[model samples]
Target: MKFAALLRSAALVTAVALIPATTATMAQVDGRAGPEFAKLFAVFQRVKASYVEPVEDDVLIRGAIDGMLAALDPHSAYLDGGDLQRLETMIDGNYSGLGLSVVMEDGAVKVVSPFKGSPADKAGIKAGDFITHLDGTLIYGGSLDDAVAQMRGPSGTSIKLTIFRPGRDEPVEVDVTRGVIELEPVTHELGAGNIGVITVNEFSADVGADVFSAWQDIKKEAAGRVAGLVLDLRNNPGGSLDESVALADLFLTDGRIVSQRGRARGETMLYDAETVYRGDMAEGVPLVVLINAGSASASEIVAGALQDHRRALIMGERSFGKGSVQSLLPLGPDAALKLTTARYFTPSGKSVQEGGIKPDIAVPQISDPDFALRQKYQTRESDLRGHLINELGIKDEEMESDSIADPRFQLTSAQLEEQGVKDFQLHYAMETLRRTTKSTVALRPAKR
Candidate 1:
């Protein structure tokens, strides 16, 4: 996901090849840290002079930059050349690739989530699966960028991925054909009883407007007033923050949508309702938002807002807990810094960092036969290395809600499939709406 806006900030660039700093500039270093700064330059000089194999200055400098950023957080990184291009392609929502969002987890490439309907998703790649090899080439300790590059090719081309899913004893191999990923950020369907179902794949540009249009189409399809609405954000890895607030605003008349708190002045900002849209578009309609372990960043923003305002019944598992925001700060023509600049909060001042947005009603996807086993390895922000901890400490019990069995979710995957329920979470939501809508002319809006 394209996380945030391109911001400009003052940077400290050190010339690795040549120490070109003037005497005046060199003197600006704080006296307390002068020894540490000297040690860095000394190591650079020693590496260049005595390393057994000659290393390019660019390579050393890039490695240094990467190492520096790597020490910060997983989301922070130095983007340039192919990395920059990939970021742009993601924002444009068109690319010829495996359509997967991956992160380096202790040197292994881990799938964050595959884009909905993409080749990876279609090929049965699940979140938390480790990609050990690409086309038989071992990539366990390889650069994530290189592994990602290997996964992308012209449409119709194919690649083999050796995956290591956590709960499995043996590694699995899958051959997947590449395709152009034209992401449809928002898609809708009119179900039985005029219940509108809108699935937000990601919070890309104009997502809020696209969702609004989808609702209009759903209303048209219904040929009358729509019943309850389901905003499906399951497995959505999140995108543009502006679009997230805009989406929340679509269903809110007034009140704060989200607030971002950062160490910088510009990073601290508040987004409120009525800023993007004037009023609630689906006023008085019952709403249920579906989120799972893959729902993160902007997805959490929307879910948290609607939940805090009592505008929607949040169902499904807890979110990915990515409350931190990353700003794409341009460093040069070909490079930018994807730095974690702020931690965002829900309308009620709750941060979804280590502990994600807890669902109002926890519902498991029992339709997937592997759901029970896969739950053991589902990767959330808390599982990430160097992830930010929530200021308000989360209790272990809060995160264990999913483990507690419920009588309502006893149906097995085979049983659900035989009953024509392809998606248990979605079916459950629609059923909830259907049962609730029977007694009211229109579902009353919750008290704000």
Candidate 2:
């Protein structure tokens, strides 16, 4: 249940405070004197005496700290008060309202993403949409915390969001009723052809144990035996690092699952299969994992580990490409700094920083009626400002597929709707597993 705070760009939640602090020191301690220090002090004195309005010392100091961290990376931040509470809510996995992860960008309130099965997502509010109005009142240039507060209310209440999508011609208004979104970190169901479909909503507490229990239930529900498994990680902004490693260990009986390399000696570590669970839970069963732009951090760890070992065939779109690790350094009792500590790499030494895990089979969500519109507005880690560059220097064009039309998947949205295939990615993966033999499920280069 211990989670290293990994945030979604759209829906930002955090937990980077639990790891052991590497270097404990004062936030503004007396250190080696630098000539720039004098300049900073002079500027502060001038602002205090000559400014038209008086500014409090606490406000100025906090602003200085935030500004310093903000320049480092998008993921590195100094969080306190409401921001700290937001991080806790991510770990708790329960909240009321639109279920949207949002941030302030250029004085505009932009949606990060709607949590899977949340009211915002159910109402079709895609990531990268700009919110200009709330209840028909203009809310531009407002604080992100204020915007998030306005969006929350008692369950059953309704809120209107005026969204302007990037590719759309005009702003669209959506009315969504607030609901208690108690995100069950994991959920599963038995599908046709004795396939067990496990959807990991988040990498929160006890993920490995929950997934193991889910596997047991899946086997019990099967008529004869479990035939295939589909690990659906779509829209799952990652959570606990330990849980992610432990979850990957469940399916990987041998070999290194992941490794972390950082400047500090404490941050450098390697994790293997038996480092967590005892053995592979599924053994010989065919496996397929589904990921998209929302699957990031710890989720990518699981996908990359399974894919490299040929334990599971990764499907769907590319992940969010967030391989950097965040360590929470305590500034004081109430506040802390979430610092980007290290970059993680797969067993094959592939760093998923700007380059996320590429699926073995590139599959798009062709069944959704809004598939085209959603694709036009997709968001990922590479899109976030101040993101660290990958050492390999992979280009953006190479990280994605063209999503071209294939004769094998010629079914249109309308045609698939008539055939009762609501999720084309899942449908096609299940069909592929039902038809193909185990030997054919081995790793194959993606057709990009």
Flag regions of model 2 displaced more than 4 Å. Answer: 1-17, 21-33, 400-404, 442-448
What is the TM-score of each predicted model, taking all chains together?
A: 0.90, 0.90
| lDDT per residue (tens digit) for residues 15-126 in model 1 | 0001122312123546899898788889888999999999888888898888889889778888777776665554554888888988788999989888888999999998
Worst 10 residues of 2 by lDDT: 6-15
Candidate 2 global CA lDDT score: 0.80
The C-alpha lDDT values of all candidates are 0.81, 0.80
* lDDT, residue 44, candidate 2: 83
Model 1, which residues run further than 4 Å from truth? Answer: 1-31, 437-448
Q: Quantify how close model 1 is to the true structure by its C-alpha RMSD in Å.
A: 5.6
Q: Candidate 2's residue-wise lDDT over 120-216, tens digit each?
A: 9899997768999999988897777888889998999999989888877988999999999886788899998998999888777788899999999
